[model samples]
Target: MIKVENLSYSFPQKDLYNSISFTLEEGEHCAFIGRNGSGKSTLIDIIMDPEKYIFEGKVEKESNCRIGYVSQFSQLDKIEETTVFQYIGEKFITLQNEIASICSEMETSSDIEPLLEKYQEALDAFAAINGDDFEKNINKNLNLANLNKCKDLRISELSGGEFKLIQVIKEMLNSPDLMIMDEPDVFLDFENLNSLKNLINSHKGTMLVITHNRYLLNHCFNKILHLENMELQEFEGSYIEYNFSLLQTKIEMQELAIADNEELERNEKLIEKLRDRATTDAEGARGKTLRVRVKIHERLEKRRIKAPFIDIKHPNFRFFIDNKIEETVALKVSDYSVSFDELLLENVNFEIKSNEKVAIIGPNGTGKTTLLREIFENNNPSIEINEAMEVAYLSQLQGETLKESNTIMEEFLEAGLKTYEDVTDYISDYGFEEDALNQKIGSLSGGEKNILQIAKVTASQGNFLLLDEPTSHLDTYSQIALEKALEEYKGAILMISHDFYTVVNCMDSVLIIEDKTIRKTNIKKFKKMIYASHFDKGYLETEQKKKLVETRIEKALKEADFITAKELSEELEELIKLL
Candidate 1:
């Protein structure tokens, strides 16, 4: 439906893409993936409106091919007062009303021909979108998403995730030939994320979604379009197949590189010796041999394997603490309740012991964020914390904790870094370049801002941390790095997250919100709940074993025990097959 040929784009600071080409064929669901700030969204913008950009590329689309876009940051600012049903059918209603108006005018107008023409045009437009059955389709979609109960609710009453899904429904009802959703799965709870997966699978038209959510990556897309190091790779397979292919290619490439290096070194030594002999004996035969060897060395250099995208550097995330809390409870909440227009939680009680890690998980609009904020504020009579613990918070809304107008360097300076050198040295570990120091935070990508939040929180030297949806915008590499960092953190953590992997791999337990109260559950039960709800019943068990074997393989490789690594690799393959 859409094709981009030899596309090259650049910003003032760096070139984003070079000669990248891809096609979105009809009925193909493609995942657009890359590291943060690698220009995934910008490329989408260029495809949607090529005239707005100054670049070298040819973007072609089928004539009259309609395109629907759901951007990363979308809000219902002006339409908050409308009911969900009305909002989804707003376009159809508008067209029907226009046609009725034209018919009423025809009853008294002298120019009946123009009125009739206008009436027919409106009817044709409405029919093009199957507007005659819009209400039925809307109800069906609502039921499929398990959101039929919310049909009469006002847009303002919906949570962030619900609002995002509603926007998706609105676009789908438009019946565009191609749909492009940029990070549409951000901030969605597990159930809602599953709803999105079902919607994508049932979609009949072409789709190009830019997302880094691992669950969706594993389950949704049939095609993968990976952008890395200013190049694009199009793979016609599932993400798992694509990943396995890359791993096999990496192993083969490394082996070839090793052999090539050995031969090159041997040729260098032989050339050195031949030159020395030619200088002593005035025969010049050694010189001819050396010339031939030099050509051979040049050929070897030309054929050397370049580093692949798998070797890209990931940010180093380290959460440190200046003082440890020895108290039994780092945080405690008893008989706590929170409400805005309605009561979301009542008589909720929970405690996090010193050095403990816990996750707050529930469906959307269940007051998880509100409860976390209340704990951070610590003004409620029911909430308490140890006096010896210092706390730091990472807000899901980056704007709450970061000043948009300030440059990266200035923000770090305000956070207590005394010198420019200190700011540069501190952010380097989080993957910020020297040139980024002068760039305004407002211009940075969503993932970059989140990384900045993490860096700031680490600098606070707090013994307790509150993180809300910390992995929402992060790429897979950074997310894995963060899991490692949180595993090693000495401080206590009370995190609010919808990411299943983050909770399973990092937290000791989960505080589930249900029936307007809090209940703590161990990680084992949480794992079973997730698997049963989203996958096969035994999938979690197999995945856990795979993780253990993978960890052992990493250790074996580091210790130069190739035999053990090979054995563990075989075990991991068996586990993957089960998954």
Candidate 2:
């Protein structure tokens, strides 16, 4: 259990909080939600007591019990001078060494049977601590991370997602009474994502989740603590309650603080006048003062003093283009072969056109990623000669490609951005904080790396964009932001993601990838289509209920049978609707 009474915090230069109060009861799960730079991590730092933040008022925590913390870093860094496995395995070494030490201390005891019993007890405790299981679980966590047989690998060699999995495994091994995870879902592949959900769901003690993954928050958490205006407000309901409540609060703040149309226009005009100055001594000092005054006015116009109401909704927008599909050949594939050992794609044939947003999907290791890379890598991305086309792709494994030496700011600057403000504004749209911009590429979290990769595609403004599992580690708000950016993009796009919410948002057509071929569909369909294609080696075999007039399968069978399958599927759909 943790308790905070009349607690307050702030920065040296700015007031982040003013006398906030909250208690995190034992077995309580809470979510801390806020926009960029609203002090979410600062609150986590206060909880961790990282020696950087100062806290006022009574704060009590259960000492003696181990506290497991997974901070906001996309991945865990291997600062320890140890191998990757050893670094993860080092967590229980202290307990192991203690057991060995206790045995040595007891070896000199007088009573023989009692000493033997004590020795056995130490052994049991040592066994229960799982020193050996630590090594195995380390491998298991890496496998879940999609890293192939990475046991002897160095932690320094792994990327952000790979490193984070190591730290998460170590935290799981500790099995502390209270687990504090700040955005643990960042950079995890699907298996690890599920593992994290199970980890949170199956835990018996307190879980303080400071995350943006609404799916996990909605499914597992019992309470929500929103960090806004430097205060943590508790919500006693589901994650849905917090989500709606948080959005509503922002809208209320907007209403309360931001001026109406006429006043905003007047302020804008005054600010605009400051930009255009007379090149004369007459306007010198007064113009400088006017510019300073305009900046203060802008900040004043944006800041809200009143406590925001938790019952409002804000407008949502997504990038969209009016497109018509007149051709069946949106995309053409001939002799498309990609592989890792076995053939992934060979003599594959598929066509894509305007009417559908096809999800390029396949299980991990099924060459879904390989095929997508080939599709994008092809020189003929467009059909018309001398016609320009834009194509963009966000690879799920894009984090693996980051250069260790470059800072985030350098990447943005290299991507054709001319100004710091422009770079910050665009990166901020993907839920990246300003502090994150300076983080070395190697130190960024898996989620941050994914955000950066997506940011690159969004920044690139390509016409035919490809995204690979863009929602794997993203928070809900970040997911929505990507949805909006993709919706407004004008050009052709090919996306690969497993997040159903995102699939529904950006997909104009569904392109289900199975066995190196693509099955395309339109958006107007059932949710059942989302995961139906994952089935192995069997179509949903159907037979007509009524007496069949010469079964199409028995008669024409090859071409007609495939066509019959389509028509029969449509008929079956109609029948289900009628029922």
Candidate 3:
């Protein structure tokens, strides 16, 4: 349990939080959400350790509480040199060392009273932290996540997502009373994100997470702490509930502002007219009118309400298909298989027709990215692209492709689509300000980089788009903006994304990559399949068989085969599991 009061914090150049106050109770899960540079991260940092930050705030905590923190980028140079097991083991190293010292002291010292007391204290501390079950807990979680393979591998060999997972797992093993996770959704694929979500939701302690992943916010959090206009607002519900409440608040505030403005204007005009008449009137009547005007002015000043802060700015993403572009299938892949040291995908067949939007959804390391790369990079005979279809690709690895030396303006100019003036207007639509144009690409934050990447690809004005996780690292506003743009795009879209919202809204069809094969289906159908699959193979298989039985039963009835219909009905009953 933690409570922050009158939390006023300021950086060297700007004030971020002004009298922001909130309390996170035991076992409460809160999502801290705000736009970029809104001090969500700074608040988390202050909570983690108030001493580290120069601020006027009272951070009250339950005594003897252990806090576990997982940063957005949990980087450690030493992680590269250590094996995964060793890295994870280091989390409990201090406890282990303390216990070891206690044991050593007990064995060597003859001082019975002090030695026994110290030994008992150390043991109690170890047991209180769940030290005895640490390894078992680690292995169980790792196995559940299908990350057991990383146990023996060095941390350096792990992928970006894997490293983040390990860091989170290590913290969870610490058994802290409170967990503060900053952007835990970063770099994670769909399956891994789900796994992480399950892990976090199962945590019995309190949580304060700063993330932009809607899935996490909707599923994991019970409360929403929105940092806006340099204030912390506590909403006692999920993100969806918070959003509805915010919309209603805005509506109410706007109505009030309108009424208040009308009243103020009327009062001012009446006062002015009274003054003009008073100048030509007798002294007694003039004094009375003057008193009435002062009273009216005082009332108006007391009741005047400031207008609500409603930010309407968002990244502008407009994608257009050239009229001269071909109207045929933009991409076709048939009997295609990709391999590295081992075969990642096999016999994949799909086609994206002009103006069609398709999404590829799969578990992490299932070669969704690999397949996309192979489709675009490899010159296989089985894969065909329409000659008239100019391709634009948005790779997930934007940090690698974007040049650090180039300024924001220079980067857009390098795309060669528009002049300096044109580029400024183009990037600003994506939340880049006039001042940001001169900022080097290297200095951009992850979200800024994501927007820049999107800007560049959209600027290309190609007829076909291949986006790999374009929604990752994007805030909700930016994601919605990009989604709207993609929805309006006339070009064909083939995206590999883990964000289910993006899939449901942007894609008409889905390419599900699993077991080295690809299955194409509509978005709604795929959802049913995935839901059934979560139960196990038996449930999904039974559901499929039930559908078949129903079809047979319908056909038998249609043909007036009463005996066959009865038999199929019995089969259907057996296959149907209680929903």
Query: Could you tell me every candidate's TM-score relative to the true structure?
Result: 0.94, 0.60, 0.79
* Model 1 steric clash total: 0
Model 3 residue 193 lDDT?
84
What is the RMSD, in Å, between candidate 3 and the native fold over all Cα? 10.7
Candidate 3, 1-579: lDDT as tens digits: 788999898866457888988998888889988765567877887787788988886989888879999988758685697988888777467778877887787787778688778778877877877888888888987876669988999887776777888888888877889988989887687778877887887788888888889878867888988876687778888775565455434445555666778887887888787788788673778768877877977877787655323444567788866543546888899998877667878888888898789998876666777777766774878889888787888888886558989998888887884687898777777777786688888866677788888887877778888899898778787788888889888888899887877787678899888798998899889766665644454654565575577677657655656667666655654554331
Best lDDT goes to which candidate? 1
lDDT of each: 0.88, 0.61, 0.78
- Residue 369 lDDT in model 1? 89
TM-score for model 1?
Answer: 0.94
User: Residue 62 in model 1: shift from native, Å?
Assistant: 1.3
Q: Give the lowest summed-lDDT range of ten residues in model 1.
A: 246-255
**The candidate that achieves the highest TM-score relative to the unseen native structure:** 1
Ranked by lDDT from best down, the candidates are 1, 3, 2
> Between prediction 2 and prediction 3, which has the larger lDDT?
3
Query: How many angstroms is residue 225 displaced in model 2 relative to the true structure, after the best TM-score fit?
Result: 1.8
Clashing pairs in 1: none
